[model samples]
Target: MSVRTLPLVFINLGGEMLYILDQRLRAFNTSEDNSEKGVWSENDRKRVMNDIVGTLFSKSFMDELLKPQQLYSHRTMKTVLTRLAHTSIMRLNPASMDRLYELMIMAFKHQVFLCPRPKDLLLISYNHIDTIKEFVKDTPVVVNQVNETHRKIIEVYSSLSEGEFQLLRQTLLIFCQDMNIRVSLFLKIKIQNPNGRFAMTTAGPVPHGIDVPGLIRTFDSKGREVRRREFPNGGSYTSPIREGSFELHGDRVIRLGVNMYTADHPEETHTTKTPSVKPNDTPNLLAKEELNLLARLMGSVKAVNMPGAEPGFRINLFNTDQEEDEAGASAGAGESLFGVINIQAMQDEQVATELALIAGQFAEKEEESENQSANKGDELLAMMDDL
Candidate 1:
């Protein structure tokens, strides 16, 4: 496996997470019932964005992450992201968090699979960084943190050989192998087949630095071109447009990692539990030593909790709390293959005990609204059923 693949995976997945959160936060802010709960104001949105982005691109964390190392196991990575998402006052219950992570993995997997060239992975990462910068434009410190990491990305990846890039891409593909969870957005756009694999189009422009198919050239013994011929190719193709800028600031040309969520085209975060095929039964278990190392790297950043007077609310990825509960129940029974990895009990007791402790750091806050009044809960349930 390529040592360089981990950064791309983390950055792209983090970007997708931000996109989903931003959309959901906006929806909450505009809801008519927002006033009943604490209103999700513009200031609240900015605080959440600033806190999460700052933690994600913090200098200490990024420094450790940039070092060459093996890719993290799925559980370890999920644990790390769980910590990151809870850095702000926002919270996710077990079920909502599982759905949120599934959406993130599948979204990034789609982008990597459709990338035109292995080298274009850098462009995709840059697109994410650029959009992240936009999210925290008002905070100079957070913007600088993002900028510093962007420069580090360029310094490390810009000079890599083509073969190295190919290896990096292959490593990513292996990580996402068999992760065919169905996403509603992808299905609506017709880019994903009913069975969960993405559909590739043959009519787009060829990858940069590549010649369109249908030309044949014959060379002589003296190493000179002797004959040239053209044949009818079945598909239409065109020359690639200009290469995207690899610098810290510019258009990224390709749109793979850019934020697809917007006010005009809103998207809900829903995913099916069943995959197209049964995933591998064997688990990719994490060793105790590796878990300790990851804990050390992540231990420095603590998730902030709201004061007693300030209220924290949960963000549900499903349409309603009842839907989230049902999904969580199925997953608890090991019936759902989240991100193609079965959430089985770890064989190593030490590792399992340690991960539980780490997870407790971001445990969901109590839903005060639910406990406040039974009549309110009934009214909400009645409203949802009516809808």
Candidate 2:
């Protein structure tokens, strides 16, 4: 279990969430039929994007997240993401949230399984970060935050050895193990089989820095190549492409973490749940100290509602209320059991004390920042008057 696994998991899943939300929001705001047009506006969509991205890359939260730590359990991660999603005004009901989570996990699981080499995981994460930067491109503050975090990611993970990357990939595979929900888009593209597993293609360019299969070379005792032989390897392959850029800016050279949802393929968002897709009912025995740390990290997320904010509206993942109801009805027992935590129920005195301290500090920081922004605005207005 690599300590580096949590950042990748959070980032990829967050990227997936942004993709789904962007599609759903676009559908509502720009549908040709006009029936869904009034529900979401361009401003509303921007606000949701800004709020979620800001909170996700918040200095406090990212500072905590980038530290060395064990990967969180699936349930704990789900709960954290649920909170992250609601950091904006957009709301997801229990059923819609469940479906959204299913789509996110399955999509990322496919990406992970199809990754050519373990070290390429960094490329995949770069793909996600690139797209995320695009999402908040208009917001310079958030873009700067993302850029800073990008540098941090490169600084931390770039120095890791290949074996460490391999371990990280294995840890991610374990995290995604047994998630087999069938997605319509993958099935439509023939990339996923009927039973939900992604079909691995044996015919393609091999990973960067790897030679194509079917060649064997014999070396003499003096380390000179004595003979070369070729064998039928059952698969056709080609030379690998140039390695992807690992810097803050360049092509990631892979599409695994890129947004797949588009207006042209709204039907692709549909997911077919199977009986084997049962939720993990076993309780996560996460340590109390870790839970406290998570609570503090998440406590820094800004409140969704503002004093002069517009009225909030819900964003449903399904096309209609009926589908949402059916999904809710079909959800397995114990699926919702661990979706949230009751902080009040924690009996640990230390946890409560730490949470209170974090809350107070966050409140004070927010207030001071608001004051600084207000003063800056006043100064800008005065400068314009002088002009």
Candidate 3:
């Protein structure tokens, strides 16, 4: 997948693929899995995403966009990672951490995992004056809020490795705690199964781990074990697997990067959550839907930073209009699960201060060079006068 440019603004792409997805979903609904509770496959990630989108964007939502609607980095994703931990995710494509660390070590740079070229930082925010004026100063209420925020942060902080701990403290925290933020931390996970096997079967009411022959172990979105019963001594040893990511939208978590198929009615009906089609739903929608459907046929997935990530994290899903309203109150200027970033939404003073500092450094260097030039000029004048 092309690693699209960063500073990706979240926008909905509509059209024919939406219809294809709708159609594919209809087929899936009638599939055998729907009739019974089956062990989740890597494909379950798609189901999770469909469930999430369907839940969020009800039939008429686009005409009436959901409350607290915000943009996504990109709805289209390449890979869905099944196993993740509390670590920094570069907006850029996945790269070797060891290699980046080596480069940083050689350069004697403190931030090991940061985008090496500072200019590559699509957007960086300095703290707003309010951080000092409104948040950090002696106001009792603000002070309490600051402490509460920091306290929660520290909890996540403790669970990290030394390198990650430093990165969070130095880089991610400054952006996350206040409105002047830049990035968010991410927790990756895998498919979940209670039993250690991947091919599982339930002979009776209870789900059981089968030991037929060659079974694999896996995890789910929340990192619970994906137990499976052993496959019969099969011809081919490998089963092609799929992957996914648990995407964060504000405080709510949804699954994304799901190349799965569950159909939506191309045309909206009042009976279900399938969103109403608008004129803008373009032709390319078919390609989009087919791609996702193919991924589902293929199946896999992968968090939040609530720390203590030994076994896995616990996730709870609930949506209420009242909660969304409350969310608006707390959401940052550009809130993200990776980290809260203020983006360029900072106060003028912060920006000016940064520019001033850069200008000052250049001015000092220029002055020093001019002084050297003047000294050389005087020496040449003395030589000429002597001649």
For this target, which candidate reaches the highest lDDT against the unseen true structure?
Answer: 2
- Stretches off by above 4 angstroms in model 3 are 1-318, 332-387
* Residue 286 lDDT in candidate 3: 36
* lDDT preference between candidates 2 and 3, better one: 2
TM-score-best of 1 and 3: 1
- After superposition, candidate 2 runs with Cα above 4 Å error: 30-38, 227-229, 244-254, 277-279, 282-310, 332-387
Residue 358, candidate 2: C-alpha displacement in angstroms? 40
RMSD of each: 13.0, 11.7, 29.0
TM-score of 1: 0.76
lDDT for 19 in candidate 2 is: 89
Cα RMSD for candidate 1? 13.0
Q: C-alpha displacement of 215 in model 1, angstroms?
A: 2.7
lDDT of 2 by residue, 45-163 (tens): 88899888887777666766787766766656776787788778787887988788889999888778767789878777788889999989999999998888889889999899999
What ranges in model 1 sit over 4 Å off?
Answer: 30-35, 229-234, 244-254, 263-267, 276-311, 334-387
Residues 1-387 of candidate 3 have per-residue lDDT tens digits of 111111111111111122222333343343434343422222432433333233222222222222222211111212111111011111111222111111211111112112222221211111111122221243354344334433433343245454543432344323212211111111111111222111212221111222233567778999999775655554422321222112223454422211122223212210111122222223344335544543453232222223653222112111233543443443332123334447675579988899999999987885565444333323322222222
Summed over model 1, clashes come to: 0
